[model samples]
Target: MKTSIIIADDHPLILKGLNDFLLEKKYNVLASAVNGKEAFELIETHNPEIAILDIQMPFLTGLDIAKKCKELNWKTKIILITFEKDENIYNEAKNLGVYGYVLKEFALAEIEHCIDSVIKAMPYFSPELLSYLEVEETPKKLELLTPTELDILKLIAQNKTAKEIGELMFISNRTVEKHKSHIIKKLDLAPIQNSLLIWVKENQKHLE
Candidate 1:
């Protein structure tokens, strides 16, 4: 059977372009959505094998829909198309069990590969996005953080509060704060006021 898919994007031209492209490729284009709400509704109704969602949309973001899908235990695999190359966003998508991450600029070239990988139950991230993240400084700094510290840093980058991180890691809030302090000192960001969060935001691309 042909792979059934639903495509969602806020832009009319892009949505039409993607729908046309997928139809030409002979995939079963079950539906197209103009926003995340519509996208989720179509997914719930059609139960398509794959969902291609733009990261930014009205009412609900693509990540929001992906999280909802996970919560509902939907089988529809999510492929997030976005202009964002932020590592923190990518990390969140991965954590939410997104099957594919395709940059909008590379969508035409990479979407087929992404779909194929997802069909095989594998994860796919755009090569262009990966290439942009291949910075030396980030890795060098990341090497200073221990595995536990790195985990906490990722949570911090996600904007998780100390209590949230503690609950997620099965630790106390005080321990989470201690880890944050160590992370700040190790990254040499303690000199600046409120630098840990700032540093995480600035260096997220490298940290990932």
Candidate 2:
């Protein structure tokens, strides 16, 4: 069976181009939407195998959709396409369980490679995106977890179950669990109240 897909982008041309490209690739273009609401409707209805979402949309952002999708346990893999290559977005996508992320500026060839790599059960980042010099925070957040801990937390926020995150990060589920515990403690977050995911969103800008 062909891999099913739904693409959501506010731009008409992008939606059409993505649809045409995926159709040419022999992937089933289940649906396309210009905004988050339409995308949500089609996604819930069709249950496509993959979803290509633009980070900036009419009403709801790609980040919002990703968080909701994680909650639903939707089987559709998501590719977040955006012009923003900042650390915050990367951290957010990693946390939200998005299957892949591609920049709008990347060549079609790079995007294709990213898609193929993601389908093969690997995380994909464009050379340009990864090569962008990281602007380190002058001083680390004392209340924040370590980089790895944050990474695990980001995946948690993204709604990835322990095992799924483990597979992506090449770590054990138990390790992810331990990181979760440490993250909670470091952030002094009360259990069963504000979720770690909330902390991630609240403090995302500082991660870079």
Model 2 steric clash pairs: 95-154, 95-155, 95-158, 96-158
User: Which has the greatest TM-score?
Assistant: 1
TM-score for candidate 2, residues paired by index: 0.64
Query: What ranges in model 2 sit over 4 Å off?
Result: 133-208
lDDT winner? 1
lDDT of 2 at 89: 87
Cα lDDT of model 1 by residue, 1-208, tens digit: 5799999999999999999999999999999999989999999999999999999999889999999998898999999999999988976776677888899998999999889977866567777776686522355778888999999988877767788899999999999989888877777653433356545655677657
How well is each residue in 1-208 modelled by candidate 2, as lDDT tens digits?
4677788999898778778877888877878999988888888999887788898998788888888888987777778888887888877776776767788777355656767755654556555665573533333453455778867766754657789999999999898878887877776655632245545544445544
How many clashing pairs does model 2 include? Answer: 4
Among all windows of 10 consecutive residues in model 2, the one with the lowest summed lDDT is 133-142
For candidate 2, what's the RMSD?
Answer: 7.5
lDDT of model 1, residue 190: 39
